[model samples]
Target: MTATMRAVVLREPGPVENLTIEELPVPEPPPGWVRIKVRAFGLNRSELHTRLGLAEGVTFPRVPGIECVGTVDADPSGELVPGQQVAAILGGMGRTFDGGYAEYTVVPRTQIIPFRSDLPWEVLGAVPETLQTAYGSLTVGLDLRAGQSLLIRGGTSALGVVTAVLAKQMGATVLATTRREDRTAALAEIGVDHPIVDTGTVAEQVRRIVPEGVDAALELVGTPTLPDTLAATRVHGTVCFAGMLSNQWIVRDFYPIGYIPTGVRLTGYSGTSGNLPPEVLQDYLDKLADGRIEVPAPTVYALDDIRRAHADMESDQVIGKIVILPISGQR
Candidate 1:
């Protein structure tokens, strides 16, 4: 009898009902590919877009996940030992092929980032993609430096909070936004110096706090608020467009000469796992182990509860990243 693993298969994009958990044969890794015994995975908006059919170039009957944390089960190349902790992310995961929403997943060796972590799998699961995007946004997109003033739009989102934590660590005074005033406390816990309740006039509200505007702004709210985000930055300041929580990325009309503020630069970040250095990941893991830093607390779900998980994610009430534990009772 062939070994089988439980996986979530989405036959077609439509609603949350399309995600179904089923038993499937464990996949084998060819030469150049590695098989991972998935411990846990993070739910991302990228997967949600794929589920809604808003994403491009995705095929049906896919295991939709962009990132997973696991131990190496097989590496035909013999470079990775069995049970070595690793994370697989991006590089056309879930979209181009079967991804991490399973007990086992196979990916090209290039997609894997190896690290040693005694942290709980649930915690580790949330780190890969979230850290990759946040760290890359700070370093590559914004070149954020110590003692700068930074603002994070959509501050309650998973990426927002992670960026806030990282910005504070970099010695930047952080201002972040939450849609609800009650969530301000959550932002504060993550070291947000100012938590503005976004009522669509974030630029006005931000000026009231910083006067000359922030030294840098991280735009995660999508194009609807991109203009206001630009207005909230100081002269020569940068805004890195990273997330599309509003699902409105396009501006419809292109008039950047008139639209962008004078001396304010706008860049975007959409990097893969390889963009994040391995030592950076290991250092963050070590900090988590030593309690020097923290990742946002995640809402964890078992693979069996994928439907509810997607429902929760779509509802947008959760404040942090959502994670899936493929093996029940793992953490």
Candidate 2:
């Protein structure tokens, strides 16, 4: 192992230019922690929030990545053998400590999920966090059942596309939203039955299709569209707040009666590594390998292109997940 590795460090929150690459010492794992030789990591809106100074509890000089896939480099506890494929996700990653924006990163054993896959690093990089959130939202947040109807508020997002895929696999009818008319094709390819253009308010459009509204709705766009999302659900149906792609999550001056409609339930989903059972991830990967499902095609970037990646994510011009391959030649 090299004594030093390349890492993108955010000295302080400001702009994409704040993300600068520097050679830093390879982090050594402490007793219960494991060091991973990072292959690739995904660019998430959460990391973008941190970089824009919008995220809470984040300190400066951080390597801001919430999810990564790689090989185990060192494990003092011997729970995992060296060179074993593993993934680490959001348990204070990129906030409380340095995260996966580097050649190597050290995370607590609990945050690690081990798996085996011959898939390329880019595809593997897009799975861990995306699958965890989508699967958790569907199962835990909404308790989605087969034949139920679903609406995704931000269908063009990586999370939205993955959720749609999972929902379809579970035998649900899906209605997803994208602000751009052109991106509707992307949603339709994933089996989304209805792709409604999000003209800031989509409840009317959603009702036009489902009439009584969808059986469930996933709110990825945040609080601004949350009210409309709630209105888009049928009685006794659920709306789960999962992502904050809009970066404005809080809803002030609380009033439940006027806010929530009769017999409708509102819930939120934020998952930990444990929320995603290993078998679930392995099953999804196996399905992917055999062509049972597809992840939204990712927009790939090399480590040197971190700034441009962040810029693209912030711009919202890109349709799917933005993935960064810190290691060269992983493609």
Candidate with the greatest TM-score versus the true structure? 2
Among residues 3 or more apart in sequence or in different chains, the pairs in candidate 1 whose N, CA or C atoms overlap within 3 Å are none
What tens digits encode model 1's per-residue C-alpha lDDT throughout 128-213?
Answer: 99999999999999999999999999999899988998898999999999889899998888789999999986998888988999
Estimate the TM-score of every prediction. Answer: 0.98, 0.99
Q: Any runs in candidate 1 off by more than 4 Å, and if so which?
A: none
What are the RMSD figures for all models against the true structure? 1.1, 0.8
Global CA lDDT computed for model 2: 0.93
| Model 2, C-alpha of 32: deviation from truth (Å) | 0.1
Q: Which ten residues in a row have the lowest lDDT in candidate 1?
A: 288-297
lDDT of 2 by residue, 1-331 (tens): 6799999999999989999999999998999999999999999999999999999999888999998999999999988999999999999999989999999999999999999988888989999999999999999999999999999999988899899999999999999999999988888988999999999999999899899999999999999999999999999999999999999999999699989999899999999999988999999999999899976678899999999999999989787788899988777
Displacement of residue 252 (Cα, Å) in model 1 is 0.5
